[model samples]
Target: MAADTTEWKIKKLIQDLKDQYSKTVRNNPDTVAQIESAVRILSFLVAGRFENGEILSELIYSASNLLVFLNDSVFKAASKYVSKVVNVTKEKIKRWLTVLEYTEVFLEMAAKKKWGTKGAWIVITIIQIMKTALRFYVLVKLDGGIGSTPAIQPVDREILKTAEDEHDNLEDAWDEEAAYSAQEKTFTLQSSGRQIRTLQAAEPGMRTWGVPESGTQSPQNSVLNRKRKMLNQPASKLTKQRKWAEGLHIARPMAHLISMYISGLDSWKPFLLACGMDVTSMYLMGDTKDLNAKEKAELKRRNMMLLYYLMRSPFYDKYTKMRFIAIFRFIAQYVPLSGFIIRPLLEYLPTWQRMYFYVWTL
Candidate 1:
C-alpha cells in the first residue's frame, strides 16, 4: 500500500510537469523564437558535440536578446501572465538562459582539455554576473519575492479531493496489510480529528505535532487533517517582523549583487555585507510568535533557501565546492561500487552543476 501510494505520487508529479510544460508551449506564440529553437536543435543533431555547439548556441541566445525588434505580439502570451507569478516571468526564462550559456562552456571544457584553458572561466563569470543581476532585480522589484511560489494556475479543489481520497485508500490498505498474530489481530479504531481511522490492534499508537496518542490517535489521519486544515485556512497577512525580515533578506542578495557590479569594491567586502544582512534578516524572521504555525515553517524554509547564495559566485568557486566534494565522498563511502559508477561522473558533474545550480532558484 505504501508502495502504491508512492507510485501514485510519482505519476502525479510527472503529470503535473507535463501539464506545466504543455502550458508553456501553448502560451509561447513567437514564430521567430520557435524557429530559433528548431534551428538550434537541428544544428545540435549535426554539430552539437562538434565545435562544442558554442557558435550556434551563442547566435541563438544573442538573437533572442535582440528580438526586442520583433512585435510585442510575440511576447503577448507570456506578457499577460507577467507579475501574476514570478516563477513564470521573464526573469526565470533569462535565468535559464544563463544556465544554458554556462552549460555549453562546461561541455566545451569537459570535452577537450585544451578547451578548458581557453576562455571557459570568462564565460562562466559572465553567466554568473548576468544571473546575479537578474536575481537582484527580481528580489527588489518583487515584494521581497519571498514565500513558496504558487502554480501558474490555481488548482481545482476536486483534484485535491481526489488526492485526499487516494490517501484515504492507502490508509485503508494499511489496515488490511498489517501482519499480526491471531491474539493481537483485533480491529481497533483511532480518532484522528476529522474521521476515525481503522487500525490493527498490533499496530502501536503514533503521535503527530504533540497531538496526544492516548492509545487511539492515528498518525496518518492526523497528517491528513493537518494538510486539510492548511488547505482550508485563509491566507494571513505577514507580521511586521516577518515583513521587515523578508525585506532585509531580500536586500542581502541585492547588496551582494550590487557590490559585484559596483567598481573598486575590495575583496571580502560584498561577502561581509551579504552575510551580515542574512544573519540580521534570519533573526528578525525567526521570531515567528506573531505568525501562525504554518507561516513560521514557511518563513524558516525561505530562510534556508537564502543559502542558495552560498552556491553563487566567489563563494561557490572558493569554498562550496570543497564542501560538496566532502559530502559526496562521505555518501559514496557507504554505497557499493560507487567508485566505478561515479568515476566517469566525477570528471564532468561539477562543471555541469556549476552552470546548472542558478536555474534552481526559481
Candidate 2:
C-alpha cells in the first residue's frame, strides 16, 4: 500500500509539472508546436521500442526541430522542471539513466543531421547533460546503490560513411605532399657488388647532396657541418622579399575566408566582427602614413565597436577566451605596442573563480 501511494504521488507530481508546462506554452504558439512535434517524435521512439529505421528517421527530424527551440528561455524552463523533479524523487538513479539515454539519443540524431554551426550548441548542451548524468551515476555507485548500466547504441553507419567521405575530400583538396613526392625521385641502385642510394631535392635549383670533405668524419659530424653551412648561407634580398610576399598571400586570404565563414554563423557574428576589426586595425597600424584623417576616424569607430561586442559576448568559455588572448598576444609581436587593443580584450576574459577554488581545495 505504501509503495502504491508513493508511486501515485510521483505520477501526480509529474502530471502537475506537465500541466504547468502546458499553461506556460499556451501563450506561445511556437512553443506549443515544438512540444507537439517533440511528443510525436518521442511517441515513435517509444512505440518502436527505440528500434526500427522508420522510427529513427522520424526521431531525427523531430530532434532537429528541438534544436531550433533550444534557446535560453526554453532550456531554462526545462532545466528547472528537471531539477525540481530530481530533487523530489527517491529513484534518482532511474531518473538520471533516463536523462542519459535521452541525451545520447538526441546527440546521435543531431550528429546524423549534420547541421554544422547551427547544431554546435545543441551538441554541446547534450554532451554536458550526459557528463552530469554519468557523474550522478558514479556518485550513486559510490554510495553502494547499484544501478543498471546504460547500453551504448551504435551510431548510424551512414553518418560514419559521410564523415569518412569528408575526410577523403579534405585529403584530396590538400595534396601538396603527394605532388612534392612525385617530383622528387629517390632510388637505390645495385652495381659492382655495392648499393648506392641517390637523393633528389624537391626544389628545381637546389643540389641533392654535397660531397664529403677528404677527411675521416663521423656521419653525425658530417650532418652537423651540412646544417651549419646551410644556416650560415645568407638569403638574397629578392628571396627574402618573395618569401614575405608568399606568407602574406597565404595568411591574408585564409584569414578572410575564415572570417567570412564565421561571420555567417548566427552565434559567432560578434566574434567574427571583432576579428575583422582587429585585422583592420592591424592593417592601419602597418600603413598609417597612407591613411587620411577620415580613415583614422573610421578605424577608431571600428575599434570602439569591437570593444563593445567583445564585452557583450558571453558565449565564450574561459579556455576559449584564453586562446583568443594567446592569438592576440602572438599578433602583438608583429604590431608595435598593440597592448592598447589586446589588454582591454584580456581584461574582459571570464574570471578564474572555479579554478581558484579547485586550487585552494588542493
Best candidate according to TM-score: 1
Model 1: lDDT of residue 293: 55
lDDT, residue 33, model 1: 50
Q: In model 1, which residue pairs have backbone atoms overlapping below 3 Å?
A: none
lDDT of 1: 0.49
RMSD of each: 14.4, 25.3
How many residue pairs clash in all the candidates, one count each? Answer: 0, 0
Off by over 4 Å in 1: 1-146, 149-199, 202-204, 207-219, 263-266, 289-294, 303-312, 316-335, 340-345, 349-362
lDDT of 2 by residue, 281-348 (tens): 34434433444433344445544544433333333442345667678888776788797666644553
lDDT of 2 at 228: 37
TM-score of candidate 2 on Cα atoms, chains taken together: 0.19
Q: What clash pairs does model 2 have?
A: none
TM-score against truth, every candidate = 0.44, 0.19
User: Per-residue lDDT tens digits of candidate 1, residues 1-362?
Assistant: 99999999999999998667545543443554566457555643443455645445444544443332231222322332222333446436444544444344433344334455345544444554554555445444543233332211122222233333555686666555443333243333456343233343324554222222233435565555565455434335656676676667545544665675573233567767777777787787664675555556666676676687666556666888788777767667877888665554455455445443232332
